[model samples]
Target: MAKFTGDTAKKILANEINVQTLLHQHPEYQEEVLRELSIMKGSYDLKRIQAMMNKYTSSAKLAGNLIYKSGFNEKTVNTFLPNIIKARMALHLLEHASIAASAQSPTKNVRFNLWDGMVLQRLLFSKGFERKPVSLGLFNFCWKFVLNKKILMPLVNQKGIYCFYSKALIRELIRLIGDKKCLEIAAGDGTLTRFLNDAHARCKATDDYSWEHYITYPDFVEQADAKAALFKYTPEVVLCSWPVPQNTYEKHVFKTSSVKLYIVIGTRNPAFTGDFGAYNEAEQFTMELNERLSSLILPPSNENAVYIFRRKEH
Candidate 1:
């Protein structure tokens, strides 16, 4: 990480410098951001948080080449997601500091634009990213208007080390269980799938495409429901990130004969991710909280957890 001075930090906060410069220099810039954010109570320099994330996400795709260039199963680098997650969570709380704030009834207008799709495709072929830590630097930049929770909160959540953490966890998983096909169901953007694929993990991504309005589903991702994907791919290892609560497709994974193990990346909040209903109801598999894998979840929250379900044939 580069030595960032208070003056340099101020300039970054003001957008005088490119966010990529900061991200490349310091992957763990989130902590500095939060520390500085304490003093930026009424400022709005964070307006560009959305645009910066757009570029960061694109850069993440480019970083895959670097990651792939590293030897297979090699842990190339660490990500700032733990700090980033905490910073974003704090930023969100800061954005809604007032008790009078109320949730807006979500409308159909919730959607992504062409930029989302455009960059996603470009990301697939992009390369030659800088050789340094990539940080979103949302907190690093100063703002221009009063922070708008409605517009910025989603980007803060959507953004961050989406492409980085998966590489670490998946490599660990495949290292544990070698010589098996892997399938990622409910793969929202296929970010994890792409990294794992690049790392030589025989993994393919599939999603039901229900969040098309919210996500620009990558061309690499097969547009199929989880159960159908399990049947079609017949993978031995199954993984999913943030599967919707009460979803049934994951339940069908166990029904498939080829699936020997299932892995889930989700929140500690019981109702936030994956299918607790299915995990609790099933009798054929042994479930355990995978601390090592879960510990790698971005933002490193108590809410993040990874579960491994190994089948026990009767």
Candidate 2:
């Protein structure tokens, strides 16, 4: 019987020491291992789960790896893997969505479906990604965004998913802005800007770069938070995608005198996205959901719409 130390736990997590082999070598350590597994299952720390999720190919593979390493019982593995897999799927969907949204030519219009399985498999588990995890996919699809949305909704509620914009929506937005200087704040990878820019709309993508975990901030995405960006750009039109619920930065957009139109791409449900509290408090602007524009958001399941806010006359 050997004592299980912090070093042992660290080695277990690092994969420096294989749990099955370790337990086989020292059966007495089983109780200690079980305790550690319990802690991991209970914590479900976002960073830790994300790290694990990145290293594996899919939810099934990830769950299998965790179960194999922990050498846990069937009951324990069942309780642990389901939720962890769901979170992992959500993260994967967001990562791929960002990649799809940032496509060089958004007008080509991407859609997701069962046909993408082969491409998805290769990107997720092929040789090129053996040394490093696949952060971006070659294409983006909205139809069947992921194998399971049951796994995606939990994270979407907490951290909203990025949706690809339609050409129609982009054209309409361009028509509305019609020469007004535009700025997109919190633009994850500048997906909307890619479409708007391609359409010759004068818009710049800006973000605080806080979501580096899920989004790889490209060179084109200007590194500025909403308030600082609003102050610097002082554009008449402002655009944002899926602003966090009860956010503090959007309020500044309302206060900025230069902004005449504030466009937000998000769900109507306050619980899903956008700073609703700020929207309600802005007496100076009138908010309306553009149905024609909303239909352009891919997959329809996202329930996302283009919200146009026009400043009321004094």
Candidate 3:
């Protein structure tokens, strides 16, 4: 790793060199560059993220209060937000690093010490603030608190609290999916993908790398949109969560012959998340609202539901 001083760090932070070229020319410096990038000013707005969570979720008020009371003036917020932003970017950077490092050294472990995690890890485990997995139960607590805490924790710590889909849900998915390959699309930050992989599920994640504000495209997540990923991976099972409202890409999942099961986690209220239109119109598969598979997630408004689609039998 190149030793970067104050001047060089500032220059690097200012985007003085094209990041793409820098990475290509000095792949060894990717991790250091990413660390600098996190310190540089970034575009993530905690208020915006919090607003979305506040509007859509209700799971962690006690935790939220702890964050809101953290005495942040303008300067503090400015400096603090970058650290939070770094945590988000590290999501991609660490993944790419793992892949690069692993090729040369299989045990290569890339861990992050994030700024945000330091402020919020303790609060996540506080009582009266557990996240509910079922959709309808999502609205009962402050999900904004939990989500921000989660995003921030990664900024400061390598090991912290993690939420996953319930074991029963994972087991059911595994049982139905069997030994088939699985793919998750638009896998924001890949929390669920990690959960699946931890359980030894034959799952991989792909994304179009659209959320540039929060992350750089990770090498591990194949940088393809839904259609392209479907064609390339040709997975038998597809997974997605809260797809863009009125999304267009999910339709491509069913169009592929290799896909037999599509698992979606979103609201049952159905204001058009995950190409529900395509699922409704398609005749080849049957859709069911799975209550049993809704464990171990933040339902946000107690309205979260997992829609499971299976190919029709002859």
lDDT of 1 by residue, 177-272 (tens): 576899999887787677677667789999877565456776898988776687789998988877654444677887888888888877665434
TM-score, per-candidate, Cα-based: 0.52, 0.55, 0.50
Predicted candidate 2 versus true structure: per-residue lDDT over 193-248, tens digit per residue: 86688778899999877667666677999988787888898999999987754444
Global CA lDDT computed for model 2: 0.61
Residue-by-residue lDDT tens digits, candidate 3, 112-179: 24533332333332222222222223323434434343233233222211233444566677777778
Candidate 3 TM-score versus the reference: 0.50
lDDT, each prediction: 0.55, 0.61, 0.54
RMSD of each: 22.7, 16.2, 17.4
Worst 10 residues of 1 by lDDT: 130-139
Name the candidate, 2 or 3, with the larger lDDT value: 2
- Which residue window of length 10 is worst by lDDT in model 3? 153-162
Off by over 4 Å in 2: 1-114, 118-161
Clashing pairs in 2: 111-141, 112-141, 112-142
Off by over 4 Å in 1: 1-153, 158-167
Sort every candidate by lDDT, greatest first. 2, 1, 3
